[model samples]
Target: MPCPACQAPSPCPQPHVGTAWKPSPDVTVERLSPGLPRRLPLRQILCLLPLALVVVVAVQHRSVLADGFGHLATAEWPWLLAAAAATCLTWVAAAVTRQGALVERLPRRRLLATQFAAGAANHLLPTGLGASAVNLRFMAVCGVPLARSSAALALYMLAESVARVGLLVALLIAFPDALRIGVLLPDGAAGPLLLAAGAVVCVALTVLLLVRRVRTVVFSFLRTALSEARSVHARPARALALWGGAITFPALQAAGLAAVGQALGLPVPPLHMAVAYLAATVAVALVPTPGGIGSVEAALIVALVAAGGPAAVATAVVLAYRIITVWLPLLPGALTLGALVRWKVI
Candidate 1:
């Protein structure tokens, strides 16, 4: 074919400026002329929100991060490596728990990846909102209805909470003197904590009773959640996976902190460190800070000290543990989140 400008050559050196762009060979068109607009697909555009958030979080904690890294410098290497390994296992445990929450089996690889991304999101928002949102969206993409997905989420939370508290209770019973249970809860603090918990329960009950719509919604959601929970429990395999993962997730978390404590040469025994980790996390679970930031640090330090570690060393251990479990993987998790979002995996 000849170019419109100069029809003389075997090949046209200058193509018409206003001509339609060449279409991709992959696209099938009914008519060749002005082939379908070669626009980018929705999935092609990479989302930047996750990366931006990672930057903001990093910048906000620059000073604390610098100091945490400084503490890590003096820590033992082998134990730190163990802590990192334990941190990795937490994601696997979470993925298993997520699968056990529903009758449908999610794609294993994608589910695990979503859990990794959810961890990063968890740190960015308060009370697990970020992680819950990510998981809900992923389930929706996987064709799970919103109601069932919500039910699964509720089931997961319930199982996780039960397992965590149960484990804590067992540890306390097994080694009553080890953690100096008295020190973990200061003399006066127990009364206030109990009162606060009771008050919250009372307030929730009051709302449910007073508001008809609220009561109806609560009952409806509970029915769905309980039905799913019962179904999961009926299957031995699913029940095992659900309880095992729920138990493992928190146990691994404690193990990670214990490893960090050992690396820092904290005086507390490894078992005691694990105990402290659980107690501190359970105590601060309701704190509103993103990932329980401030509350976690304080509760952890006190708990570790109660377990017989020096206050300064306990502080160092908490800081270094957070660096490994929370800070270190944050960016990569965010990048993975961005990739998953770009690929429409979640």
Candidate 2:
């Protein structure tokens, strides 16, 4: 029998299966699809979550905020602007590095914007977790298989860590007295620490090799990671972007801190100041603070003092730098994150 409404077939008023039809402009009806995991009611929740997080973080760190604002009052605007510019460039560097970790090319603008949004997400959770979640979701939405996306994430992290430590070593070699790195470490501790770390790695590797099932899984993952790495690095452009962006990310961060130190008249020289920033970051890499908030500040201040800046001045410089790099951009970054969620970008 013909349908009364459409006068065509048995079924009446069939819904459109394609994206061209929507029930409403503001509302979204999500039909489940492979590889896309989330579809939350985003309009209000997205806005409120960031707002609440802002309040919570603010109330918790009010004193630090007060001190930073005090130092910021007398900051040199020109150099502060330079610091801001360098901070922004870190996002571009991250986007490039991420692209370099995979064979397929990502949409440049969206990747860059996702990094920006990832920054805010990063601060809200523990070190690396928030950004990893955001990027994983972004990759999933981009049609990447879960296993390959995980491999890419691992490669990106390994490359970034290597580049950061390598840059720090290069800087130390270039300027032997740039910062008193030995003083940053407790006396006679490095040897024991190194031995302990080696032992731990050896034990873990031994267990992995001895267990048949474990060894099989480990080899499988290693093969995947190596294959992906080779494929990405096989292309010169991707390889260059990977290593170049990895190096640039840390270098720009150091430069931004140096510029802020200059603005605040920290007694340390600019290059030495940069060395301080790098050493501080490297030292605190193991500390699991949200964005390394307290730990990073303390390490930076200590590093600056080791680099010949006065204790008081180093404290002020760190405060100002954190304000510019973290707090100042936080709200806008959160808003961008919310917007991306609403648009189903991540």
Q: Point to the candidate with the largest lDDT.
A: 1
Relative to the true structure, how large is the alpha-carbon lDDT of every model?
0.88, 0.87
Which segments of candidate 1 are over 4 A away from where they belong? 1-46
Candidate 1 on 1-346: residue-level lDDT in tens?
Answer: 4444555474777756787655456656655646567766565444577778778888988987988999999999999999999999999999999999999999999999999999998888886898999999999999999999999999899899999999988988887765777777667898888899899999999999999999999999999988888899989888888999999999999999989988988877788788888888988988888878678989999899888889889889998999999899988998988899988888
RMSD of each: 7.0, 6.9
Question: lDDT by residue for model 2 over 1-346, one digit each (tens)?
Answer: 5543445675646753542522334443344344676755556697568657867887899999999999989999899999999999999999999999989888888899899888887887788887899899899989988778888999999999999999888888998898876668889999998998899999999999789999998788888889999999899999999999999999999999999988988877898998888889988888888888889999999999889999999999999999988888888888888877878887
Per-residue error for 210 in candidate 2, Å, reads 5.4
Q: Where is the poorest 10-residue window by lDDT in model 1?
A: 1-10
lDDT for residue 57 in candidate 2, whole number 0-100: 84
Every model's TM-score: 0.86, 0.84
Query: Which residue pairs show collisions in model 2?
Result: none
True-structure lDDT of candidate 2:
0.87
> On a 0 to 1 TM-score scale, where does candidate 2 land against the true structure?
0.84
